[model samples]
Target: MIFTIARKEFRSLFAAPSTWWMLALMQFLFAWFFFVRIDDYLQVQAQLTQLANAPGSTIAVASPLYSALALMLMLLIPLFTMRLIAEERRNRTWVLLLTAPVSVTHIVLGKFLGLMLLLVLIVAGSAIMLVTLLLGTHADLGLMLANILGVLLLSASYAALGLYFSALSKQPVIAAIGALGMSFGLWLLELSASDNRSFLRAISPNAHFQNLNMGLVNSADLIYFMLFTATLLWLTIRQLNDERRSS
Candidate 1:
């Protein structure tokens, strides 16, 4: 039942022309950033060749690329997530979904899963540029894989939160702004805080992703992302339930 709903939602995303245009814009941004970063990395590599060998040289070489990719993904996710529920509500289609035989939980999970599937496509597309970097270069494949996984998990978390916000608003434009504002604020909070307040860092997906960006697979970070995504998804279901009952 959930898969049926998911399929419907996933197909709806592609039925619209705007989704394709947004995806194309995102791909162009990623490709442009990749080219600039690769050029910068090559220049740095040439300089490093003349310098003494540093400890953990391989990790050092890969960190910049991972960092750049992570930044690019952070900016792209909100655009995809903004339309998850808000647009449906705006178009009067959410009521139809609410009146369906499926439970609110099923609806929320279905939409979430649909967005996640689309995210996989976006991430896989961006990965082609990263793979291109491996040609004639000494890149750590394991580290790169870990970074990609981290980005996916991080993007999922953001998508979940954005979807929740989308469900909360009937206005898609408001949902888009709200999602971006919330994400940007969370990023700012994590960046402004000190390590002594690391407990607060657990609340920010970007913070957990920072560990992943460093090629460190901490169990705590993985758990944080899972819990964050699950919690927000639950909230979305609850919101749908409340809205349905009120209607």
Candidate 2:
């Protein structure tokens, strides 16, 4: 049943022309950045070779791409997630979902999974470009996989937070703005808190993501992502249940 809802949401997103336009825009931006990075790497290749411990192609090229991709997810996921519940509520379709046989948990999970599929598509688009690195240079497979994992987890956290905001507001624009504000706020928190041991930096998703982006996958970072995602998902479920009771 969760998958059924997820599939429906996935198809619905693809049905909209705006979705295609957004995807195209993202890919275009990624391609531009990717080529620019490659060009820069080539320009500095000679200098890097002279260094005792020079970074590889993966570090020089793919790391920055993934970092940019993470920033892109922060901006784009909210746009899609805003419509998940807020639009349905605005259209008077949320009542249908509320009265449906499926539990609130299922609905929330389904919506989140649907968004995950879109996130995966976006990440895969970037991955396709990263794969081309193998042709010209030796790519760091381990680092690449770590970055991929970091991206997926980071996007999932974004989606979960956005989902909660979508449930909180009937206006899709408000939901989008709320999600964006919170995401940016957390990023600011990471920046302002300079101490690595500070609680604020410890709670910021960007900090944890940076750890994985550097290919240092610690258990602490993994746990942070899990707790962050699970807490928001739980809150979303509770919000929907409260709405169901109120209605």
> TM-scores across all candidates?
0.91, 0.99
Worst 10 residues of 2 by lDDT: 9-18
CA lDDT of each prediction against the hidden true structure: 0.78, 0.95
Best by lDDT: 2
Q: Candidate 2 — which residues are off by over 4 angstroms?
A: none
lDDT of 1 at 70: 67
The clash numbers for all candidates, in the given order, read: 0, 0
Runs of candidate 1 with Cα error greater than 4 angstroms are 52-62
Query: What are the per-residue Cα lDDT tens digits for candidate 2 across 1-247?
Result: 8999999899888898989999999999999999999999999999999999999999999999999999988999999999899999999999999998899999999999998998998998899899999999999999999999999999999999999999999999999999999999998889999799899999899999999999999999999999999999999999999999998
